[model samples]
Target: MREGEKEERTQPFSSPEFAPVKLGGGISPQLIAGRKAGKAEKVHLVIRRLLRQRAIQEGKAFLDLGTDSFYPFFQQYSATQQALQALGDYAYTARWYPSSFGLLQLREEAQRFLRTRFNVHIDMEKELMITAGASQAFDALSRTFQGECFLLPDLAISTIHTIAIANGARPLRIPLHPVSGLVNLQEAARLLEREGRPTIRFLYLNYPHNPTGVCATRAFFEEVVAFAKQFQVLVVHDMDSWYQAHISGISLPNILEIDGAKEVAITLLSFSKEFGLPGLRIALVAGNAEVINALRIHNSEYSVMLPEPCQYAALAALQAFREDEE
Candidate 1:
């Protein structure tokens, strides 16, 4: 090798051009730019892939903090086990279509669960539809309301932000209160004022919020309802963790519990966290009949269904919950 070339290679490298950008909350500006260019997967998917590669090489067990560690509680509950055995007995002849609004029995049970738990009443036929999971629910919403502005918490779920971006929707992150971990409505109002309120489409909310475990109060939800109504924006509340036990010993308020909230808000509920049934992929989307109908029609064209087995499993879990209540 040439002497100068050898010296250059041996020298300590110091180049500003090679400096890396710091990632904050896994949502880096560079990452967002890459997603917009269609060059990146969602953050969790990327992490899972890397972890799988490491596990294969090392042959070591690693805990996935993002998911439950055991099989669903249904496997342990005798009632659900009996229910599943009965379902298997008829598996040969049970016919399920490619698409369904949801099983009538599951929806009816889900409605009862909501009323008994949150004291929130919903029409089983018009106000509720089963989804494969919360992610699919978000996917349907992103498509149904593409190209509109979505207001999201700066530190909330990265999946929601990534999905919104990929679907051509404009997502604006608003800062949450540092201590309370709630969205700053004043700041949100300012953004709406500056960006023109009509351009905004959905106000995203979460309780027993992911990653932070912060719960929303009924008063806060009332304020959110008023804000959404005033702005004429639809609210998408991700209540995926609603069924999970909170450390605070407080019963979480369903956004629908607030009067007038039903006119402006719809909520997504998942059984994964509470029942450890992530693989089953059954969830519910409930709220305003108009918005629910829009999602239903959009999904019909694409054809998505929560399989009968999953519907039945969810029903069994709800029944167990009801029995416990009794």
Candidate 2:
């Protein structure tokens, strides 16, 4: 080497190399770990095997009611159909994309809906958003508010199951009461106490509850709000089936009605269930102005905003809902 010339550095080896050994039929055991699938993946294989065995014995005529999802075959209300028809020409030309929060007209209608229906006042521009659906809304939120851990109900939609996982977040499970099928609020409160509340950044509670069909009382929501404020945890309340409560002659209270709920809670109200328009996929979200703004930003970058015509269709669903009441 010449003086003042720098030597080319070589990466140092930590251990001696082993001689290459041939495996059976040139197959690498490390490359194919046929035995290394996780329990969740293995469960699907187990179900397939059980299904095949059952088919052999039962001749493929059996019914399985294991999953929560059910076929929705209800008739479409006329107002909804007519509204989509009204959008026939505009849908093609209504192409100017909307705010990441959602369309202005839909948000305005939703603002009125909240005033008349829930008596909650929100600034449509800052505090409310029109989103694709519950899953998409939650996906954006789970990404927006990600922290040390997210607390999810053990019995929740599959979307909940995967949202935290997709974000590489550690999710802690909150179980519901086995007998009443209501959220085990006491257990949750205890966990919050134990986990230093702020460490668990969120508590996702859905009512007019999915899967279990159990609803929570306004008193419970008040308790949740107080607890959330105390612990510095954000409360996510899903009111996707709020309309069903009214249809069933049951009064479902909104958490936002409770005092100070705005500080700690956000509510998701979905039109897909009420309007029977899952394919169109629309929902409303309202909460703290800061959080809503964060959601709006994340949605603009990472998610699809609700289209203009679908926003109009959501307006029609509201019209039909009122007509049905009359």
* RMSD (CA, Å), each prediction: 11.0, 14.7
TM-score quality measure for candidate 2? 0.74
Candidate 2, 1-326: lDDT as tens digits: 22111221122222233345576555444222322212243354356445644554554432323221111223455645655564664587366875567766778878888877888999998889888888887778767875777777877765565565555455677788888676777887787667765366467888877767787888888888987887778888988864444436777888898988999888989866655566568889998788788888988887576777777777776766656666
Tens-place lDDT digits, model 1, residues 208-250: 7776778888989999999988888889888886463433456
RMSD of 1: 11.0
Enumerate residue pairs that collide in model 1.
none
Clashing residue pairs, backbone N/CA/C < 3 A, model 2: none
Reference-based TM-score, model 1: 0.78
Question: Number of clashing residue pairs in every model?
Answer: 0, 0
Which portions of model 1 miss their true places by more than 4 Å? 1-66, 69-90, 242-249
Error of 2 at 320 (Å): 2.8
Best by TM-score: 1
Q: List residue ranges in candidate 2 displaced over 4 A.
A: 1-73, 86-89, 196-198, 242-247
